[model samples]
Target: MLRNMLTRDELIQWMRTELPRLLQEDPAFRAQVIGILSEALVSKGELTRLLDELRAMREESQRRFEAADRRFEAIVEELRAMRADFERRFEEVDRRFEAADRRFEAIVEEMRAMRADFERRFEEVDRRFEAVDRRFEAADRRFEAIVEELRTLRSDFEQWVRFSQQEFAALRVRVAEMGIGLGSLGLRMGQGLEEVIRQVIESFSGAGPLKAARLVLIDEAGELYQPGARVEIDALVTDGRRFLVEVKNYAKTDEVWAFHRKARFAEAKLGETFEKVLIAPAATASAVALAKQLGIICYTFRAAESRETSE
Candidate 1:
C-alpha cells in the first residue's frame, strides 16, 4: 500500500536516500550496476578513472568543510573581543556620570551660600531706609515748629501796627482842639478891636446912633432863614442913614465876599437900604479890591493914621 501511494518525485527522493546505503551494503546490486556499465562498453580504465574522480571530489568537499569551520571559529573570537571593549567603555561612562553628579552638588551648595548673603544685604538696606524715614520725620517736626513761630511773629506785628494807627489818630484830634482854642482867643481880641473902632467912629462923627454903640445880631432868635442860622453886625445904625459893618483882624477876599452876602441877606429881610462897611487892622490888597467891587467901604488901621476908602 505504501509503494502504491508514492508519487514519481517521492520515489526518486526515496531512491536517492537509500541508493548510497544499498551500494555500500548490497554487493549484488552493485555488481549488477557494474555489469550494466560493462554492457554499455565501460572499460577497466574508465572505471579506474571514475573511481579516482569520485575520490578526488570527496577530498575537495572535506577541505571546504574544514575552511568553513575555521571561519566560524574566527567570527566567534571577534564577537568576544567586541563584547570586552563595550564593557570597558561602559565602565568609563559610569565614572563620568558620577563626576558630573559631584559637580552638580557643589554648584547647589554655592547657590545656597549666595542666597544667604543676598538675604543679609536686603535686611541691612531695609534698616537704612527705616533710619532715613526717622530723620525725615524729625525734619518735618522742626519745619512745623518754625511755621508756628512765623505765625506768632506776624500776629504780633499786626497788633503793633494797629496800636500805632490809634495813637496817631488821637494825636491828630488833640492838635485840632488846640487850634480851635487859639482861634477862639483870636476872635475875642478881634471883637474888642471892633468895639474900639465903633467908639472911634462915634467920636469922629459927633454922634446919635454911633454914641449908642449899636452892635446887634441880624437874627437873634435864629428864626430868620433857618434855625441856628444867624449873622452878626459889629456896628449897625437903623434909625437914619443906616450902616451895616463887619470887623476882622485881617480882612481876606473870602471875608469881604461873605460880608457882602450877609448885607444882601439882611437887606432882603429888613427891606431897607444900608451902607455896607468892612473894618480891619490889616487887610489884603485883594480884599480891598473885592470890597470896592461890591460897593462897600473898607477901613484899615495903621500905627500912624487910619487907612480908609470913603468911596
Candidate 2:
C-alpha cells in the first residue's frame, strides 16, 4: 500500500510517460491506477472548489503584478526625465564657464599691455630727469663762478676805498696846519703894529714911551681875558687914554662887532675914553660898514700894499 502511493511529481511523470500505454495494454491496471489515484486525490467537489480558489488567487496575483509593473515603468520614465533636465543644465553651466574663462583671459591680456606701456613711459621720464639734472649742474657751476668774480671785485673796491680814506685824512691834517701857521703870522704882525702905535703916540702926543704893557685886565671875579686867555693882544698902548686894537688876516662884520664890544667894556671899567681900531690884510665890505657905524677905525693892509707898489 505504501508503494502504491505516488507523489505529485511521480503521478505527473507517470501520466506523461505511462498513461497512454496503460489505457491500451492494461485495462485492469488502468482501473487499478485510477482507483489508487482516486483514493490519493481529493473528491471532485473538493477539487472543483480548490481549483476555483486557486483561479481567484491567480487572478488577484496577476492584477497585483501588472499594477506593480506599471508603477515601476512610471518611476523609470520620471527618473529619465530628471536625468535629461540635469544633463541639459550641466551643459548650459559648462558653456557659461567657458565664456567666463574667455573674458578673464581678455582682461589679463589688457593688463599686460597697460603694464608694458607704463614701463616705456617711465623710462622716458627717467631720461628727461637725467637731462634736467645735467642742466642744473651746469647752472650751479656758472653761478659759483659769478660769485667768485664778485668776491674779487669787492676786494679790489675795498682796497681803493681804504687808500682814498688815507689820502683824505692827510689832506685834512695839512689844511689844519696851514690854518695854525696863518693864525701865528697874523698875531706876529699885530704885535709889530702895537710897537709902531706906541712910537706914534709918544711922538705925536709928547707922552714918553710907556713903562709897561698891560697884558691882562682884572675885575672883581678874575682876569678879564677869559674867552681868549691863550691869545695875545694885537696892540695895547696907553697915553693916559685907553686904546684897543684887533688884527685879523681877513676881517668881516663879526670881527668889527667884537672889537666894538671890547672897547665899550674897557671904557666903562677903566673910567677913561677908549679908542677902537681894527687892522686886517683885507676887510669885507660888511666889516668896513659895521666899523664906520660903530665909530671904530678900520685899517687895511691892502692900502699899504698899494703904497709900496706905487713907490
Predicted candidate 2 versus true structure: per-residue lDDT over 1-311, tens digit per residue: 63379888888887889778877799898889889989999989999999999999999999999999999899999999989999999999999999999999999999899999999999999999999999999999999999999999999999999999999877754553344335447456653344544543454446665532433344444334564343334566765665666667667777677677666666766687766766565767767778889987776533222211112
TM-score of model 1 vs. true structure? 0.31
- The number of the candidate with the highest lDDT is 1
Query: Which candidate comes out best when scored by TM-score?
Result: 1
Question: What residue runs in model 1 are displaced by over 4 Å at the alpha carbon?
Answer: 1-195, 203-227, 302-311
